[model samples]
Target chain A: MKFKAFLTENGVILLEKRFLPALDKMGKICHLFLTREHAFFLHNLLSGDGVQSIAQFHKEALFDDYRISSQNEDRIAFAIDISLLNRAVRSSVSICSELGGGGSTANRLQIKLVKKLPPNSTLPTPFLTFETKGYKSAVIQDVPISKPLSRTQVLELQTALDMAQDLPQTLVQVPDLNQLQNFVDRMKHVGDLLNVSISKYGDLHVQTSTTLITLGAEFRKLLVIGEQAFAPPEDQTFSAQTRSERAILRGDAQSVQVNVKHFSKSLQCHLAKPDCAFYGIAPQGACLTVIFQFFIPGTRQTDKSISLHCRLPVLDPS
Target chain B: MSSSAVDAEAPDLVCQLDNVQGMVDALSSVRWKRNQDAVIELSEHGIVFIVEETGCLQAKVYLQRELFTQYEFRAHGRPRFGVSLGLFVDCLNSFSVPGHSSFIEIRYPGPDMKLLLKSVDSLDSCIYAEVRTRIPDSISWDYNFEPAGSTPLTFTVKSAALKEAVDDLEWPGSNIQIKLQPAPPAVTFRGEGHGDLQIDLMYYVNTDLLVAFHCDRQVSYRYKYKFLRATTSNIPNSVIKDNRGSKLSIGRGGMLKVQHLVSVARSSTPHPHIDSAGYQQSSRIAYIEFFVKPEEDEDAVND
Candidate 1:
């Protein structure tokens, strides 16, 4: 296996300052999946509990020059401590900034996978090394990572990823994150589980209740995503009632009960400064998905280079 | 529904307060410990919250009826309930959004006998909370504080300076001695532990720092430092921000009574009300009082 890449100036700022720090708040360890086309940071994908987060970045978005080779169809996957990775990247950025005096472009940051003898041990260990080269000084940081998964293990992970990618039937855009955060923080004091309901009619209701009291907040007239924006074509009839039809007949919204802590952790994504955010609940789904959308600077176009979302595990109604 | 039916179902007490932040500040001033229970009593004149620490300390927060934008009471008698002090403060704080002064409507005896609070400012979204309340238990200690001498031996000092002096005296000390004398008209606070530290507020030195002084005779008493500290520890920033003064008076048997007045009016504009004389005035204020018993071992010294 071989992997090496030179991070662009924008990559250093985004990775070291925005992405990694936000991911660090979600979980301790993150799975770094490297493919020929893109890189994926997966959290709690293999675990059965906790909030699962996936952050995807295209090769050109971060890497100036990228190369990777492995037996598993040129795909490499390994787990590493999120904080350790963040620290290494942060140190590299600081070193560059110090040498360049404000323009990190003067320093070159290269990350590569290598095998070397770790200090206080004779046996060699696999490590991800970050090398920062300036005019006359160089700094290297070694961060230990889990051994690469075998071909079969990689296949299993791919299957899991495919299952998690299943999108909800309807998506609705939520309000400003700062407002939502303030509301959620207050709900946290009321109960452990938050009931989130989203309607195709662009209505969002969040509530928390205990045996002693019930608290709720409602946001109406939100923007519904495409196709689901209006009622399904009247001509298309079905043998059985669809989820949306059931919702309409019942005069209720699709609701999911999730841990408040998990929901709050996902809200930390506001640090990434997404252009907009959407919330959706899959039909008979066990998780509530929150997608953060980023747009290209100075344009109305969505930036397809980066995609980030979080899936919060739902609690059993009983 | 008939008008009579609607009246029967209406809450016993309904009030609206636009300055939620001011109420939050007053309640938080008495919240020294987590999970503390405060007994709330509602009367036609105002609402009172009584929190006590067994036999050592007691605090009362009085919110006058004038503090609210509208106060309506139809109950036959005073209604009392008990609630968690910390939770009450936190719930009120949520209604106050930063940079936006939200109006909150408070009602007692919600459908389930709970306290109902609703934010009535924004049209897009409405936030409502119901807090659980229990039957209030009988108060444990009630001490009538009569003047210790012919004249009330009281002294008033800037809240900020008083808080600073009390905080600075917290150095391995278990008890703090308060001394007041008419000669030269000065008040002294001495804490003795590893060493001795004394802070004196004299009438003639800086009138601004020592706002008021009154003493007919010399009086000295020692109080538990912990209980004394609780009085000034949580004086809300709003009080200090307005440059208010806290008055400390000594009653019979060396009981120390600390009083602070918190204005429960919007910072930008005060709530205007018409008096019987047809004059407009702002009378929105909350009174907070703390009564601490002096140490039993230390006898009071009077000359």
Candidate 2:
């Protein structure tokens, strides 16, 4: 696969010309120059497909807002469009790696602009789309999900969307209350393994306390159960036994009733695939793990043993 | 077991048997006499009599008061069986309170035997009033015994005055029975001067809250009972000959004293099975002193 990197007004614009290793072996090359006029031509040429063309698709123009100058030597145009670049391919491309990065190691530069190419156009000769064509995939529909998106692609796509923007938008759309409620309910069913093992994707908006998660679905599929997990020995005084602890997702079954025992407790969430919203990593997973540091009241310590368990459905479609 | 033989010479002995028979017969009849005497005086008010006759027909009467404390009883008798006595004291117009009377009902197993005493309003019927105006000090008694040939003999009796209050009974004037029910133990006399006296008797009664038994032991000493603190002091018996190992020695100060016997002492004061925080309070305050067999070495006074 071929990538073009060049300096522009804003800083640098790196374009992934071809994304398949096999296509790179076949000598596929991308030749879009880093220039504004070339970006405009590319935008107009493929503007009429089901694909979204973001480079010259002016939002500010319709909103009567000022236009900013393109940062790169060329308006770095990009698209999920494999058809248009068919003419550029020398041979069929086979896809391998799963992650996408800003720039290669030799070229440690940040991308400052982005555009989408139109769909269904033939691959330009000397450039090729990977025949295997598998990256992270997501399914979107008009219905507001009552549950979180349990799949990995939801987070992957949301993160990619942020990185795809020339400037990350400070205001992101949050999932509705019904969606969060459903997600929370569904979270009770996922097993402990899935609850702590899966990855999560989150987005932060400028003006809200709610962290909008794009792929909180995996967490929604898990439930947290059991009493607070870390307690001192039975002989320790409540004051002497003071320590922060988290709840275990698997122990006893989760009861529907709110336990008076669990009042005044909180946990820090660490989702595997973090975005601006929940961008901490202690454990990696499509799952979410949290460390609940609770200042439990002294009267509650006892010889009593508590266990909790949660049921997790396998989200793998296979 | 058979009442066939008797000393024919002593007619008084025959009469004594007759009086005993009368008393037993009267008891079987369940006859209780109300105020039948107005001025008759007595000491050592002996009530419950237990009779066991074999070698010596022993008749033990539990006395509430001492031998010198006077009481007004309406009965006259020459006791028949061997007499073993108990005593109790009932005070009239105590502390000069017009209606406040204190009565001590005692049983005599020992001088330390705690009697059951109850105090109520002067208007309450169950309290028997002791008329202190008529008889203040104690009285002496002389005993005469009599035996009957076969049938029990009845003797005509007389006393100075009929006691106005019987058993210290009180009642609303409306319920007061003027006539004696079952014609109380006949106050009969052959003499003309012995007549029933009519007086505005304030009270007449008999009752108990808790029963007590007689106890007699070597620890015959003065005890001051209190609702709060009880005090005890012993008067030295200089005359008591020291019988080596026969009896224990008294404490120093010949007059050994026990003070600060509080009814509601601080829970910290020693007692068996009392937890510091778990002590319970009693409704009424009472202090009592009694000589119990010394359980601990320290409990006994060291001479």
Candidate 3:
């Protein structure tokens, strides 16, 4: 197996400084899947509990000279501590930036897989080494990673990732994350689980209840993605047949109950500076999916280079 | 009364406050421990929350009728109920968004005797909460603090300075000694543990720091540092922001009473009537009082 890549300046700033730090807060370890087309950070994919997060980045988005060759269809997957990787990247970026000064993009950051003996150990260990070349000197950071998965194990992971990508039938955009975070923080004190309901008519209702009290918040008039937003005007009069048909068109609201902690952890994605977020729930689904959409800076177009989303495991209603 | 007649009558108590943050601050001042039960009594004048710690420490938070934009009480008599202080405060805090001043409507006897709270100011979203309340038990201890003498030995200091001084004295100390003397007109707080630390607030030293000093004789008393710390530990930021002063007075038998006033007026938009009214009634304020019994061994004396 062989993997080597040079990170672009924008990639270093976003991936190392923003994306990885945000993902680090969500989980301890994540699988770094490398392929010719893209790189994916998969969290909690093999675990049965906790939130599952998938952050995808196209090869060109983060790397200029990317090359990877492996036995199993040129694909490689391994688990590594997110914080350790983040720290290595941060140190490399800071050292390079310091040596190159602010304006000069002369510093080059290269990452490659290497097997070397770690200090205080005789046996060789696999590490993802970050080599930052400056004008005068170079700094290398070694981040330990798990042994690569076998071809069968890689196939199993690919299957899990494919299954986890099942999108909900309807998706509705949520309000500002800061506002939602403030509201969810308060709900956390009320109950352990949160009931999230998304309607086709563009309404999101979040409710938390205990035997003593019930607290709920409703955000209405939200834009429904891929569907026309609708609200019956007060002055309009609808016939019985039309009203029933309209109701059918609106569809039923999908409801899911999820752990409050898992939901809150997903909201930390705001650090990635996504332009907008969409929330959806499948009909009688066991999970709630949140999609973070980023737009290209200084333009209205969506950034196709990166795609990030998470699935929060739902609790048994019974 | 028939069930229909009871249903026809308005809720036992319904009140609306333009800014719920004030109520949240006042209640949080007395919430020192988790899952602490607070007894709430509603009268025509307003609402009073009473929380007691064992039989030694008692705190009361008074929210007057004027504090609310609308206060309606149709019950035959004052109603009292007990609820978790932490839960109630947290629920109120949820209704308050950081930048937006949301009006909250509160109603009692909601369906199954739950306290209903709903935010009415947001057009995009509405937050509603129901908190369960239980029958209030008889108060364990109620001390009618009689003046120590003809003139009560009281001193008022800036809330911010007082909080700082009290917080600073939290070293290795079990008891704090408070001494007040009229000769130099000063109040001294001394905490002795690993070493001795004394903080003096003299009337003539910095009049701004010591807002008021009314002591006719020298009085000395000792109080548990923990109980004393509780009085200033949670003085809300609103109180300090207003530059209000906290009044500490010594009653008979060395009973200490500390009072703090928290302004509940809406900061976002001032009502027209607020300007017409005089300074005192212009803005509504919540009153918080804490009563602490001095240590038994230390005989408080008039020197």
Candidate 4:
């Protein structure tokens, strides 16, 4: 099997776009588990970056094509050093710039890889070809891909937010991503928990309070894309909606508590690509699924869009 | 200047400024290399906060008098006192809103008194943070480098290149041997562990790195990697001011001196109180100098 992708002059842009989201925030090292249809990069450590809070970053175009040798549908996992890759690509591209051949329209990267023997003796030597109309250069690096990373305990996601489609929900389109980022930045140190409440009238209220002071931000005229009517649990409440989802639909106000720092860090993805949609659903605990649709820069031919799924875990407010 | 001034004017030294955020950043930068408690020396030149680790490694941040908006030190002699760096930092940051500025009034009320700070945030509310200070015992910490008797070797290096080089050389050994000369092979850094790892960069060959090399005599010394490593992060995070680079100086006893202009932490506003030297004299600009003495092992190679 082979893997490859064409990228712009500076390899860093492509590197951050594809691998940064999939890998954990703090420590970029992760084990890539390949399946028949998609590849899963399982990060064993808690990333300092908000990616950990963002349960996962799911995408379809992980690799152009990653075929398995064992079977058509085989599972193989191998540990990869993301920082090393980041460093190597960074150094290599800088060399191109130092040599006076980079940052020009003629500069481009062509990567091609072939898996090594013994399932994974190590990754095969990858080919790095830097070509311009007048000059061409290449560098070959034998990256060391080792055994799968092992973990003591793994938190199995009880329920994926996307799987609960039947639950009543609402989608809010954030036209300006910077507004949310500014709020998170301001309220980052205010409290431990960031409480987000959504009202039926399409109002979004973000608040955090301490014994000393309380800070809140309100956004009005948020379009409530859609909501389905549902009944509350019989034992939950008689006069009001029975289930939490019903209350959320009726605009009784659905709120969720999450680590402020993580939520703020997770919003960093929006900085790279601002146009995003917030999908909110109220189960026993509320959850936010941010869908980021961004373009792969320098691929002027296709204008193909890449979709990234960042799921945040909502804590049950006591 | 009254010898028996009013009680309000009885402070050993009181400095007022429209902002104390600059001092806050200068204090925080040394935390990476020094101890939680630092000795602040108020002298004729300026105020120096010294952070030392086991007396072998030390970092000094010099806040010249020009940095303060209102400066006056009226004491019979230079006063050296100690306080918890953490508490002092907390006091400095108490009333600061993320990006905006705050007013600060700092005072040291004679010896054996507390370090009192008064600040007013944007809301016009006032807050106070008092940290008890102590008359430090008669422990001598020398702040002088390149003494009167000895000449020093110095060079200018691109900040980014030094950071990259340090990163490449880190973890290879417990100590790093540096060689500088007025001849060819301008700079050489060798880490002798896990197989010999040496990097030789010529002045003209690696012009992107060495930047400028100046030396009157050949100087080679072996400094403890642990001490030298502390300066690693300071390079990359150091904001390149006025397009100038970090300065490196080697003196007698193999004491490595690294001086850089560190941009004040957090605040993006341009520093105030410009100095003719082109080096900014605001809290936004800090003059940081690191001194790492060579390990005193009698058997350190050529020693």
Candidate 5:
């Protein structure tokens, strides 16, 4: 829907579009300017009347009020709202230039605005002189000019008018396919770990709101610097500080075998299931140890061993 | 814009066939509206019709099991006059925020009578649905206000188009059946192996008809959600029933537990008769496997 532009008795022009109707009949027919907002205001003023009363004037003058050429004989011009046009205007002011020429006759219209001289102020009155060189310039005179309106100012003014409104509540950044797949995998694991079924699960997910703040110095050392920068020279006790003190407890490649210990024990016992009994005794209490270890893949790393200590009662050989 | 210009700007019907294919191609890749309660809309006759949003797991199953059935059918026949409905449904179902409905509208002209393609397989049907469903999109956050520990957060949730469909469903063929398999991970280490993991997927598809013989009649079904959970920890002291890995299913309700698989260690007790070595040998490695049994066996029926 296009906005209606109207000139008020105060000579200020407003560009707006609203669903108001009866503002026309209440005042003198010759001088009254009707807009959807004015119609809405009248609807409010009349306690019992519904939108129907205002709709009557909308049928007669709403279109005429919206037309750029249509003007009421009275000096009052009612502005109907056009948000798109307003947006274009607000955006246009930023890149607008005084340089105009070398275009078709249709592109030769120019608007001249003269800044009002402030009281007792010696600051020269600024005149925005629009001239189209090599072509006859259409001159519009006596336009009350202030500083070109900023987008913020225009938006503020536009918002001040009563209208149906909705605010943007969500903005989602689209993730690449690989990222989405990874996220889906992570979400599924989370769901599985939590013992919850994620049926009807959507491929789309809200990006993780979690953020990590690391010190500049630490981040660079931990993430950017390579292992060659801290390679130990084979002789002395090699030690290096990581981004966090916890890294000290969890030793890296160079410190892998520093305080490590290992034990290999053998025991002879009886075997209850003698199906393949070739290892000698009647295996009763067989001692067995399974070792679990963790290690980084490359760069001369050693496995960290954690033994599951187990003790078995031996036969009374008395 | 002039009429011809508007028509030029007007979305091309044939090109959208490719778009529909593109949507189907990257079905799982696109994020659906997160919440189970969200509605998806389809534009027909300039009016919006909303379909229901299924929760996470249910949505995956719906896409994998149900969508493939339609995708296969549409690919073979009815390429031009394809339903192309699941794109709208899948998009709404997959990407919306949890507890929120994603309002999406897929616009199309009513039937193009001038370019009607003769149906070789069977009679084409027009299905019109006027459905209204509510989807929850608001998540309540509870926490104590401590300036030191406080994290400032800004949250936005759009109200799902309450008046329109949250999901769209269509049958592109006479018979429909869909099966899904987890896509293999891009990178796998040569020697190292990882334990059991879950992967979620989706399919955006349309079918000409579901249950071919019943195309003459309307087969209506409501989409819902259910969650499943299970415990994979090999520790014995951990809570057996509750701590076991679980699955959360979302559909008609908000979040639900679909399944639970507890580690075998939790179930087995140490027996004096059996030594540690013996018990370790007998320890049944715990891992979850899935299987589905069809109700009506066509082979059996034929036999």
Candidate 6:
């Protein structure tokens, strides 16, 4: 009926502030499923960041993360106003800091939740409590969650088109966030869509054209993530094999045409994350994927990797 | 004339903090959209940020002297002045550059003084910024709350508990009605908007939440959820870390007061729930208070 947990304060903060806000920008509501070992944020807003955006967390990527007093096979799902969660989290963080939380001193942040209240209905209760034994402080927050969606739909757009032959994209690492900012400024006047062309040699071109003028910036020497990274694990079909082969057979350029606004929004990841990896996913299919990894200075381990797939409406060029 | 003579005003007060991020983070918590400009009052204690919303809601945050490494105060009349909160928050947030050792110094000598902000970056480079000041008006409203015995309702609960309640009921309603009773359903909150929500908190039943309870008579009032939500938005659910949360007071007229201990390093308390301030285990003791006015002239009690 009930379970209590001691989760990492930093993980909770990251969920509330960063991940939730990112989802809110894409849509009004999101579905969060929490299990003993994992938390998943699933949303299908055609996120200007792309077609689908999913942020997941396994316990290891968490800060001193652990689960307690719970039965196996327990999962909770609820639809919530992502923006409201943003505010709720801010409230929790400030309260914790004021009382000397988020430190080694008060190591434990105890959170307990009950599935049913008044001992009857199947519906969950309205509140959850976050407490720390070291400080003997407990924060009981109303779990502002709502009824789950009728059906949890998986919105991953599985495409038959290949990233290597059909897209022939280039991968680039952003050295500075300002560069992305400048790209966005150029995009404002460029038209509704951006034409991103990447050559096999890593010459990445971001081009925008209006009725009168066309602006393009070519970045050279951008480090490309190894081919194996993009290869789908099971079949490993059209990954490093076809990508290098096509470049050698003919000097071909892979380009993906995506909404200028969506591409720019994805670039925003540069502000919160130190490094950004931009991948041109589907040129003809109209999708761009970006993955961000974060490091907190001297921290030994890191957690979840956020992958954003921004899909533009596909066009048939016969 | 030396450069100092050209700017003859020697700053009135100056303060240095080992980390400016903490101070900025403190201010960032109260960045509610409905809030107007704030007044920075300086004294022997430290700086207190006053944020008021439409005159109906007010949150005063007091960051004590112990928070800063270096502190100095010098004023003409009262040690307080007004500034644009947006600009103030921006100046504080500029320390986001990574790996940069942000050694921050803030100063202003006297009235009509340009607020000076100087900081050392990670590379030992110094950055200086100046912002024009707004004239300090006599505190537009009097905060002089009623003295001692006249008070009617008061109790303490974990800030987390109250904040969660406010947050849970925030949606689907423009106004939130709070009903605090002496009976079994000690606290009831109703939210009415696109959809309505009614949640009841039993005094002894919700054991982990209600830290202390004292209610003599049944009292109820309605407030704009937008305004009420702003008060709890910045509160950290657990301020003292011990089970003790924050204090809530309701006067006869429906002016709700929320007092929270923002910082506490001292641990001199047998009952964290009962006492507002106890033995100090927390080095920093910042207290933030919010006064919210209830909706008046209501015909219908239930939506």
Please give the lDDT score at residue B212 for candidate 1: 92
TM-score for chain B of all predictions: 0.92, 0.17, 0.92, 0.80, 0.17, 0.78
For model 5, how does the per-residue alpha-carbon lDDT over A129-223 read when each residue is reduced to its tens digit?
33222324333223222343344533433332222111111111122223223223333311111110000111111111111100000101111
lDDT of predicted model 4: 0.55
Task: Point to the candidate with the largest lDDT.
Answer: 3
Window of ten residues with lowest summed lDDT in model 1 chain A: A235-244
TM-score, first chain, each model? 0.90, 0.17, 0.91, 0.61, 0.16, 0.67
Indicate the docking level reached by candidate 4: incorrect
| Model 6 regions more than 4 Å off | A1-318, B1-10, B96-101, B110-112, B120-123, B147-152, B193-195, B236-244, B263-281, B298-303
The C-alpha stretches of model 3 lying farther than 4 A from their native spots are A101-106, A226-251, B1-8, B192-197, B268-282, B300-303
Measured with C-alpha atoms, the lDDT of residue B261 in candidate 1 is 84
Question: Considering only N, C-alpha and C atoms within 3 Å, which residue pairs clash in candidate 4?
Answer: A232-A242, A232-A243, A233-A242, A233-A243, B12-B110
As for candidate 5, its interface RMSD to one decimal place is: 26.9
Distance from true position, residue A288, model 4, in Å?
A: 28
Question: Residue A50: error of model 5 in Å?
Answer: 43
Q: Per-model C-alpha lDDT, please?
A: 0.82, 0.20, 0.84, 0.55, 0.20, 0.57
Arrange candidates by lDDT, descending: 3, 1, 6, 4, 5, 2
Can you write out model 3's per-residue Cα lDDT over A169-196, one digit (the tens) per residue? 7788888998888889888887887878
What DockQ does model 3 achieve? 0.41
Reference-based lDDT, residue A23, model 2: 20
Q: Evaluated with TM-score, which candidate comes out highest?
A: 3
Tell me the lDDT of model 3 at B114.
83
The parts of candidate 5 lying over 4 Å away from their true place are A1-113, A116-318, B1-34, B37-58, B61-303
Off by over 4 Å in 1: A98-106, A226-251, B1-8, B192-195, B267-284
Task: Write the residue-wise lDDT of candidate 3 on B44-149 in tens digits.
Answer: 9999999998888999999998888788988878899999898889888889888767688888877678888877675566788889999987988777798988
Model 4 ranges off by over 4 Å: A1-318, B1-9, B18-21, B33-35, B110-112, B121-123, B140-143, B147-151, B235-243, B263-285, B298-303
